[model samples]
Target chain A: MSVLVVLEQRGGKWNRTSFEALAAGQKIGQALATPVTAAVLGSNIDSLATEAAAFDIQKVFAIDDAALEQYTPDGYAAALEQLIQASTPKVVVFPHTYQVRDYAPKLATRFRKSLVSDVVDLKTVSGGLSYVRQLFQGKLNADIPAEGDLQFVSIQAGAFRAAEPASATNPIEQFRVKLDPSAIRSKPEAPYREAQRSVDLGAAPVIVSVGRGIKEKENLPVVEALANALGAELAASRPICDNGWLPMERQVGSSGQTVSPKVYFAVGISGAIQHLVGMKGSKTVVAINKDENAPIFETADYGIVGDLFEVVPALVEEIQKTKA
Target chain B: MKIIVSVKQVPARDSSLRVDAQGKWLEEADLTYEMNEPDAYALEEALQLKEKLGGEVVVLCAGPQRAAQTIREALAKGADRAIHIEWEERAAPDALTTAQLLANAVKPESPDFILTGLQSDDLGYGQTGVVLAELLGFAHATIVMEVEPQGDAVRVKRELEDGWFQHVSLPLPVVLTIQSGIKKLRYATLMGIKKAKTKEVKTIPASQLGIDLNSGLVMERIYLPTRSKKTQIFSGEPKQAAHQLVEKLKFEARVI
Candidate 1:
């Protein structure tokens, strides 16, 4: 009869995407005429629960446990399983994040349910709901109908706006989970950053990014020449960085840096939803690829359906001439 | 150490897709298939571990009869043997059902560890590995970037968002979903291909697994994504299109 949105936080700082999940939950709750509740699991997360309570939800559950401080699949899943058993929410929503991807499926499986993951949109038909998620690396969209008594769904980033905080103050409850120390496997060490990020692509005015279309590591210079000519930072999709052709810090996608430069030149990159979500904020996106139906073209403002090898060099020369 | 690598066969990355007449799946005709890219990395990781530790590497795949091609590619790349769970359904089963079938197959091997791609290229569920681990009562980690075996446990480096990584330690009988590009994939050699043809491939029908195929979630329809923006395409010679793009960037968009 109610919707439960799980909010994720690390070291007591909210992962902004949690609000987007709240927004999605609120919309679903209104549509179904049900109450909406939220829960944040961590040690010393009372403030987080209070912050969430101000967001127009009916109640906030602060599930605190000393073992839940650092994220472990066993600890979080076990804790959430207990919470769901106690509350019995009809629908569960989460933000499709790396942390969620790690453990949400395991939690859902415990209840004989499968999570409809990375959902981009939702529709109500005949008083029932269907979730839309991308397939074939975002080449196609599949509509999955919502069935079963308990439904677990995760919303994609940027699919919903963050819920606005209101003056209404709701009740906050402290739910204690009995977690056994021995049951928690996978001891986690401190998280660390590799190779201090030297170039912040976020501040750049223009960025020229490459993808699998470049073909070989030897051909990278073709795109580098254009980046140099335009005075733009050179970035690349996950495959380029995974190949070690480009440094990991220069990668753009869900796991890498998210940039919003004024102009994003996607040279030979067929847009996967992972890469598209990172650079979709660019003011002007220009894509150069041989395939006209590449998903990059769907988000691009201007596109050239031709070989990047031939188009990039000519564009570099034109930009240099205009600068002169 | 005995490692079982779970792989999948998906349509080639460059294939043009058409919806099937039922609108429930892709058209099978005129489609080329290849080993799922992420699973290729998983196989490579397993092969490397086998080489270092001098144990067996087994590839486990679940698909239609065509999946045997992908299994051969894995064996050629250096797996000791393979297990194929023949599933001929047109529409893929949900993640939970797929994991249950895999768990039933993997239970007999009792491998020291299991490795699979973080997600498949086709369904992109990204949950089968973890769910498989749970069904088998094993500890698990996803997005694993590195793995080093200890006496009885393994230490793995897992990728977090925004370029952060955390090192985790788990005991044997664990499941680790490998991130793509963790290691370079080895191509199938003529000699290895010959050996692969002779290697053991045990085929088990899905019905023999005795797991229910009915999935809770149902695919209502499939279609191309709607365009969010109006893209003005310049189609012609490469030089002419480049010139037109520069003109638009300079004047119309004013980004330059």
Candidate 2:
């Protein structure tokens, strides 16, 4: 048995989700006694070939084509379907990303199989394999098996650990698949980055955020001072973002960016599941809310139940003193 | 233009959940079922689109008889009519199967566009929209926040990571998965609620809709989630404990 992870890249850059998929695949592959290999489809993916070796992957299959320059569901799905057929993998892993959402099921459908998607946990069941998927807006979880020998699965963002680059002398293979022009039904245009967001939070490691507790936009300076001291980016909750206290990009919620920062300090922000779904996987969660009963406290490793107006300044002073 | 919005009924978010003795899904006896939150957004988006673009909006639901309440709610909010594709509780097929069924059931109508929630509150598979697009061979996009009819093509804003957004234009006859909270959901008007009872609600079986569970995907089992919890305490004075807790948050939980 072998497992294949479809590593997704955009604009010639590997997405963080691909890393999450590799991490999930490594564990599942070990449990199933199958080696984990990654299949990447893009134009000149060889440029990013070194990036693939960081994961504890057994092998790397990189397919190159001009039609794959941009992300089109048909082009990528066709490429993956052909790649999977050659590998005959028992399980397919993907990040529950927008790209996967577009085509994973179609690829599964072509093989007469179905997908068990957005999984939060992967376990070795008594029979074969089972995965835990969250339901009811990140509340209940249910275990489901692939009904057959082959299964397709997508993991929730940040569900798996992207441990420090796994040290392995994993070999890379150039997988050249014959591409049928007809299979590529859609031609992708050049990827255009939306001009709205000034700061792309996808890559930020440290985020200092204030939420409803800050009261107004003027109070943002208090949190900004802390973020500046820590050399971290400043973000906010939905209410603050909605009220234009910060740019929409700084908002961490269902409607905003789904981030997994190394350190996320949420000040005066109530932890709604919608917000939690985006950043709960942060490496460190620290919350400061005036209301001790705030939901954010449940998820915070360190909870500060106090007024952000006073606590933030003190925290900023402490951090600045440390820096000095 | 005629558009179809696919809806699913799900337990209310935050509703306490439990598994029955059969190791199957819990009964919603004490719980209340509502039109899945994300789906309500889809219905709202479709209704708004129809209002502006001059078209008919049809709400499609696939579930038990009780799910008709959800459809009635949709109808009362101005869905021209409703389609009830009935199935047993256990018969709630996987995303691929449901997408196939939805494609076949709606193919006869040949709606110009189809919209559905990014994912359901119950299963949260988030696949049916994309699968249906593939099954019907329609150009598709998922997690759409903004949609504007641009001549024959539709311009859409796709929600992505870290406040990132993508603007893509797809030609008509497409499928889109609507994101929640993109637009305000509409409530049924008193007049519309009274008129919904008179609207046509067609009932069809999963089988009659050319959706055979035999050829479709099957499930092996469904069980409860496994959970294990542990607690750790820092022994010291209040101030020291607070410092230790912050340190743990940074080093251990990595959630600071």
Candidate 3:
């Protein structure tokens, strides 16, 4: 039995998480004692195929087709279905990306299987494989065992470190898929940014992010004052931006910007996995919330269980004094 | 512009969850429930589309009797009617099984559009809509932010990662999983709530759907996530805690 890792690329550039999926695939391959084969699909992906071949894998399949030049669930799923049928790999892995989410389920369903998505960890128990994923917004963890022979799994971003390329050069094979134009139902236009991102939160040294715990739009300045005192950019969770209190660009989470500031101050945020995945890379995390059980503290280096209204103002005052 | 919006009832966002004795699902005795957040947005989008294009909006939900409350909320907000597929099992089905059940109920309607939440709050399979589309031979899109009905098709804006957006046009009879917070939700008026009680709610047992219930994925166990980091908690008065935090940021973190 062999493992196939499907890598995602847009405009010839790989999604960084592709390597993470590769890393997870490598580990899984080792556990199962199977060879790992990587696949990249696009019109002209020879370079991508060669790049993937540099990794310590058995071989790379460059599934090239003109229909795949643009991503539609139909084209990608149909092509991958053909590849899977021909290769007959025991396992299929993806990076749990937006594009993968769009098509992987349908592809798995074609094989009479379900995709175990956003898997963060896996282990072999009694010679059977089991995958671990977050549930209830990361409050709980569930262990799901593989049921069928051909298991479909999508690795969560950051769950596994990206695999580095080795000196070994594997074989690159070109697999052409025959896709009919009429079968591609959805017509995809060019992807575009919504607006000129006014705030470059990624470059910010420090960010004071607010969440549902902040109460109301009127209460925003309580945290804004803290951001001002610390000379940090003001950011918020999805709900705050959804309420129009903050612009969509200022939102930081899975749907918004992913930031890795020098310091991240999470004020009244409960640290749902959605928000946690975005900011977990921050060098230093400080959480201030009334609920001591808030999941944000799990990722935080330092935490204070106090009302933000009381703690934030005092902290702002203390910071101003310290800076003075 | 006939539209079918699939929704699920989940524990209220603020309800603290507790694992049941079986360690397979949440304890349901004391939990309050509401319409799943993203599904609520899908219902809202369906209602808006019906209002503009003038067609029926049908609510399709699969859950226990408690799910009727959420169905009524959708009818109160503006769905023309609802189809309730009663699933009585305490253990939720996998995404494929759930989609098969939904597809069985949805096949008779032949709706121009089928909208579902991007993912459920509980299982979070995030694939029922796509799987349903595959089952019913309909085109599908996920993380849809906007939908506009064109002549015989629809134009939709889908959210990509990192603030990017892609516009796609799909022919009618498509399934679209809506993103959360795409549009503001509408509350039920007192009159609408009263009217909702009189509206038609067709109930069908999940077992009668004639679909296989066997799931491809099984949950072995469920438990609270173990804390990976030992967070340093500062316990004291708010002012003193703030002072301590400031000092730590300067000396320990060195960010400010």
Candidate 4:
């Protein structure tokens, strides 16, 4: 039996999360005693498949098709369904990217299987494999067991680190699938970024991020003052940017920019999984939230369980004094 | 055009969630429930589209008897009618199973458009709409930020990762999972609430769908997230804690 890891590619560029999925599949495949094969689907995915073959995969399938040049739920689902039916793999692993989110469920349903999606981690249990997924935002995690013979899994981004293959000499195989034009329903225009220039949070040395605890738009200036005192760039969680309190570029999370500043000051942020994953790599994490049990404290190197309104002003004064 | 919007009742985002006695699910007794955040956006999109394009907005939800409250809320918010798929199964149903139940309920309606939230705030599988589309043989898109109808086809702006967006065109009978924060959510007026009482709610039993309830992933157990870093809490007055934080940031962490 073999496991299939679907490699994501767009415009001849490989999505980095594809490597993360391959890394995860290799680990789980080893436990289940199954070989892992990486499959790349697109018109010109030869280079993408070749790059994937450098991983620890047993084989790479270059599933080239004109219909796959642009992703449509109908097209990708129909194509992958045929591939799965032909080569019955025990499990199929994918990176939980937006592209997969578009078509993965349709693919899973075609095979009459469950799509255990946005899984954070997986482990081999007594008799079967169990995937871990967060519930109630990030407060709880559930270990889900696979039930059917053929299982589909979508691993969340950054859940697993990408590791190199044992050697860079894996074999690559080319496969073609016939797709019906009539079956492909959605016509896509060229994808474009709305913002002409996005602020690169990754290059920032220090970032002061705010979360839901900031309460109102007026309170943002309190954290803004703290950010100014520390001489750090201002950032925020999804809610702040969503509320138009901050520019979209200033948001740090799975949907926002991933930042690894030398110092990350999280004000009133409860550290939801999405927000945490974006800033978890910060060298020094200092959290200021009123709730003692907020998840942000769990990840913070230094945490103050008090009202940010009071703490932020004091912290700002102290920082200015030290600078003086 | 007839549009169907799938809405779900979930624990309010700010609710203090606690694990159940079985350690398998959340205890709903003390938790407050409301329309899922993203699904509310989806309902708003459907209502706006109906108002502009002249169609009936039908809200569909699958839950226990308590879900009727959610359906009624959707009706008050401008849905013309509703279809409630009462799920009596005790086992936690997976995304595919839930989609099947919805597909069975939706097939008879043969609506030209379908909309659902990007995901529920609770389970957050984010796959129900796509799965439902597949089961019903409808073209689908996800993370939809904008929906514009163009004659026989519809154009949608879909949100991608890293602030990128893609515009796509799908023919009639399309499904879209709406992303949150797309537009301002509207409140149900007093008149709308009264009108909702007169709207039709077609209730169907989950057992009547002839679909296997236990056919997918099963939750083995659930527990609180394990903390990787042992956080040292700074107590006392706010000023003292702030002073201590600055000292630690400078002397211990050395980031400043």
Best by DockQ: 1
Candidate with more favorable, higher lDDT: 1 or 2: 1
Interface RMSD for every prediction, one decimal? 1.2, 6.0, 1.5, 1.6
Q: lDDT per residue, candidate 2, A1-74, as tens digits?
A: 68898888888777776788888888888878888888888888885766786667778888888777777777
Residue pair clashes in candidate 2: A257-B163, A264-B256, A283-B254, A283-B255, A284-B254, A284-B255, A284-B256, A285-B255, A285-B256
lDDT, candidate 3, B1-256, per-residue tens:
7899999998987787888898988888869999999999999999999888988999999989889999999999989899999977674888999899999998989899999999998888899999999999999999999998897899999999888999999998999999989899999999999999999999999989986565568898988877889888888998899999888888987878
DockQ of predicted model 3: 0.79
Q: lDDT tens digits, residues A4-67, model 4? A: 9998888898788888888888877987889999888988777777777888778888888888
Q: Chain A only: TM-score of every candidate?
A: 0.96, 0.69, 0.95, 0.94
Q: Candidate 2 versus the native: TM-score? A: 0.79
Clashes of each: 0, 9, 0, 0
The superposed Cα distance between candidate 2 and the true structure at residue A62, in angstroms, equals 1.5
Candidate 3 Cα lDDT to native: 0.91
- Sorted into a CAPRI-style docking class, model 3 comes out as medium
Alpha-carbon shift of residue B86 in model 2 (angstroms):
1.4
In model 2, the runs with Cα more than 4 Å from the true position are A50-56, A163-171, A178-250, A253-274, A281-298, A302-324, B88-91, B210-256
- Output the better candidate (2/4) by lDDT: 4
Q: What is candidate 3's lDDT per residue for A243-295, written digit by digit as tens?
A: 89899999998889999999999999988777887898899999998877778
User: Once superposed on the true structure, which residue ranges of model 3 sit more than 4 Å away at CA?
Assistant: B212-214
Instruction: Evaluate candidate 2 by giving its C-alpha RMSD to the native, one decimal.
Output: 5.9
Pairs of residues at least 3 apart in sequence or in different chains that clash in candidate 1 = none
Q: What does candidate 1 score in Cα RMSD to the true structure?
A: 1.3
- CAPRI class assigned to model 4: medium
**Order the candidates by DockQ, highest first — what do you get?**
1, 3, 4, 2
